[model samples]
Target: MEMIEMNTRERRRMTLMTRVAEGLLKLRMAAEMLVVSYRQAKRIWRRYREEGDVGLVRRGRGRSSNRTRPAAERKRAVALYVKQYGGFGPLLASEHLASDHGIKVDHETLRRWLLSAGLWASRRRREAHRAARERRPRRGDLVQIDGSEHDWFEGRGPRVVLMVMIDDATNKTLARFYEGEDTAAAYDIFDRYVCQEGLPVALYPDRDSIYVCTREACLEEELANVGPETQFARAMRELGVGLILAHSPQAKGRVERRHGLFQDRLVKEMRLLGIRTLVAANAYLDGTFLALVNARYTVKARDPTNGHQTRPTTATLALVLSWQEPRTVAKDWTLCWRNHRLQIDARHAALGLPGRRVVVAERRNGTLAILHNKRLLTFRNAPAPAAPRLRPAAPQAPHLTRRPPAADHPWRRSALIHRPVFCPPPTSYTAHSRGAENRAAATPSRAVPTT
Candidate 1:
């Protein structure tokens, strides 16, 4: 007798059908045991009589699936993956193959081929448990802002920090590449965003020093009626924009995940384009990359209304978005700031401005403005050596001197001396009135004496 290899279920079914065919068991009993209909069992029973155990095997077993790709195609795809797209994930590789290489295949199909061909490795990522937060209802309702320091040029150029601003509602993205991540870069990028998208209702950022001040004094302010703030925070407050600082990176996961996506896609794209500088990268981003990113990732907002307000005027923005500090005007109407002595106008000092506190606004464009009582004061750069000097008038002719009053004058009658004592002015000031006036005009506010 010939022996055939079969699994337990097939052997059992075969035995029952054989018994039925041999008249040792009823068809209904055979069907019941084999879990098949009597009609199906009868069919099996007839096949068993002629073919014996051969018919017991599954019909499609050991046969190539009709859905399988051709052997030649599979081999070609694996070779292409290994040679060209070895570092790309299955989804990205599949996209390139379909669009660039004229090859049509499902991502999973390509993935399996790459895996079997040892061109790619599989990684299982554990899903993180997080409380889902619904997106804001309207565009610009909440703008998530973050800076990602990365090699965006992917070794084609220097590393740069990409400052990204994403609308929480629509996922619309605005980004720029900078040399580094700092307060100035943040200000510049945000200023550009405001111009492009208007003022967002609120900003969501992590607790970086640029976004939040962590000093003890700042914390004290938080406990007081005043909240702790940084330059960026202060600017937002001045602009009437709300701030929501994330305690952890996961709190603002949208921007964080975007950073990761940008690092992968943007780097590869810049590499392909041979972009090597921040200016070129930013130009490409604003013109072309931004629209592509938005069209691909953005979704409709829950509400149709836009939350952004009209952008502030340039002058208003210059005042509010600048770095401001309260500085006291020196007695001479000079403001010492950033190692430069700025001399306020003598007219301002004549208005009793000495020792008064003024706000020094350092604009993003490297210009400075001195504001007192919300009004801008005129100032000039006063270098130490070139500062205004007080020089007295030259001595005048003796004829210019007036004669002393007579001893019998009423001013001397009850005086301590026979004649009213005339105290000579300092030698620095001569008897020449015109020369004295000119010297006084040139003197610094401190050097000018009051009568």
Candidate 2:
């Protein structure tokens, strides 16, 4: 007897057919149990009775699928992948194979082939558990923004930072490449986003110093009893958009995950396109890559309503999104900014521009302007102050001549040789005693003390 392989369903059917053959269960009941049509059950019963348990096994077993690719095609795909697309994930490699090589293989099918060929290893990551947060209900309600510093060019060019903004509701994204993650990059990307999609109601950003002022309050700010604010924050406030700072990268995980995806797909895409510079990368990003990403990733929001405000005018945007600081005009109608003296135009001199505060704005285009009460003021670069001249040193005084003292001068005489001499009488014992008595009699004694 030949051993036949049968799955659980076949074995179960065989048991049911055995019972039906014994008249223990009706064929109709067996058909109901197997959830098959009565006609199909009858055919199965007839076949089982005629050919035994072996016939219950599926005939298609041990036969290749009709949908399977030809051996030559499989070998060719594997060869192409090994030669040119090594290290690419199965899905990405399959896409490239389809688009570039005309090999139409499903990513899942290609994954199995790669695994079997030992070209790709399966990765099973144990992800940390996180509570899922529901997305905002409307598009433009909250946009998550982040900067990913990456070797985006795969050693073909310098490493760059990719600034990305993604909608929390729809996953719609906008991105740009910059040399570094700085205030200027943030401003530029944000400006483009606002200009294109209008202003989102709220922005979600990490607690980077570019998005939030992480510095301790300065003396002036402390005296004013206010917290420090970054230029980005100030711009958002001026535009009436809320700035929500995420305490952790996970808080804005939408954009963070987008960064990961870009680092994978965008890097490979650029590498394939031979994009080796920031300018070319950004051009490809805006022109083609962004559209592809948004089309694939964006989904319909719960609410179809748009939460973005109307886009502001170009002038308004330039003014609001600029680096602005207050400068006090001096008595000469001049203000010092970044160590350059800016003289207020003479036409404005009659307006008493001196001793007034004006905003010195450095726009994104590297142009400077002075605005007083939201009006642009004309100004010119003041000439540098002239260096002071040093006075000549005073004429030197004439040299003095010294005279030597005379040899016979008083200053040169010895004191011992010029002194006068004195003589005294010689003392005797009898004369000494009489002199002492005479001196005692002549001096009155103080006898009142005894009395």
Candidate 3:
């Protein structure tokens, strides 16, 4: 009986209705899966036949529905919101309308209106989550750090970026810095996190070039593992911080989701509450915002044993992460770097080793520190002994002060002479004569005159 009823609609696509008609299907299962009426399915089939894929498209293809505000006005409002209020959603826009535009609407009602008007995510497709993130057991065990560029304030200011570090186990934001996205920002953020929250056992972060580096093409083997070590990663490693690479954003969904709340609620609230400056934002975050947010969501156990240990001092870490190259000291206790000879006062009896092999750690930015017996002996940015490039020598011949001979002289090359190979035909007059003789023959002979 149910199968006969389903025969009413002609389904072109592989909907459950068509599935049942094509083969075997239980009535209950078909009813559950096939939500469309039989007639609707037939319409879909008819549309497919008539217009192919075009007819099968969902209704109101290009044009928006009536509920949407006028294009110019909606765009104006959206622009205003973005500029003035940091791009709040329709619901948040209601406050703006009342305060500035003099048009007031309920937040929920505005959301529906925006949806009906086709301005909201009702039309946006959902992205699939890829990886599973297993948060560490302890609060201080692991922290996921990332940067987000957002209009923290409405349009009152320029776009600002936040470097956020959130603890894995407790979902607590340990530290936040408002700065542009870059390696320096990450380093500064790391430095602050260390001072404030102490060093976490591990860090889960996205792969950025600064945290990694690439080597030359020919020397692939030499630089095979030349990963992110512009500076920040090196410092982190020096501090004995664990680095975990996340293949996809979904792998760090905890931070990803936090970013969403930050973009939506926290950003909007900042605008409404008039938090403009980074210092102000930092103050607000410290007061209670982060604590409340963490308490609400970070419902996980803190790692029993605090994962952090003492921060390896700068001198020690320098040996570990610095760019190292082997070198030997001279008899006079001097080292060579380019043309500059770096002389350290090892001659004093206080120190040991008169002659020994040592390592040179050259900083990418500046300064060269020497290491002996795993201890940094002296530091100096020695002058380069020779330029990396050698200038080409002028021809070995001697130079004469006087000018050279003219072009006509033997020493000088022959004077360049060129002739026109093809001349254009005469257009003004018909050319019958090759020379004066032909012209004389054509006209009355000048014989009398010649006589």
* Highest lDDT model number: 2
Per-candidate total of colliding backbone pairs: 0, 0, 20
Q: Write the per-residue lDDT of candidate 1 for residues 1-451, one digit (tens) a residue.
A: 8877799988998778767767899989888888888898888877777788898778888998899989888887777777776677788778878887788999999988888877778898887898999999999889999999876777778878999999999888988888888988889888988998899999998888998886656553556555667888889987888989898888998999889878877776676578998789988988888888899999999899989977899998977888888788787778788988899887665568788778899998889999887788899987585657779989986877678999888777767555567887656446577687989899878656789
lDDT of 3 by residue, 1-451 (tens): 2221122232434454345555676435554455666566566556656765445446564677787656676555555655665446775577777788865666776666556655565447688755555667766787888887777886776677877788787777754646578865676676666666676788889886756556443453246464435566666665778788877787777888788877787776776678888888878777867776777776756456656666655545434444565567767567776556776654333555446667776654456777676576754444545667878987887766897777677544334334336887865344634555587778884555553
Residue 392, model 1: lDDT of 94
Q: Rank the candidates by TM-score, best first.
A: 2, 1, 3
Query: TM-score: which is higher, 2 or 3?
Result: 2
Over all chains combined, what TM-score does candidate 2 have? 0.80
Can you tell me which runs of candidate 3 are displaced by over 4 Å?
A: 1-125, 129-131, 153-155, 216-229, 273-280, 302-305, 309-343, 347-370, 379-451
CA RMSD, predictions in order? 24.9, 11.8, 16.6
Whole-model Cα lDDT of every candidate shown, in order: 0.84, 0.90, 0.65
Task: Report how far residue 154 has shifted in candidate 3, in Å.
Answer: 4.7
Instruction: Report how far residue 291 has shifted in candidate 1, in Å.
Output: 2.1
Model 2 residue 158 CA deviation in Å: 1.0
Report the CA-based lDDT of candidate 2 relative to the real structure.
0.90
Candidate 2, superposed: residue stretches over 4 Å from native:
1-4, 222-226, 345-357, 372-375, 389-451
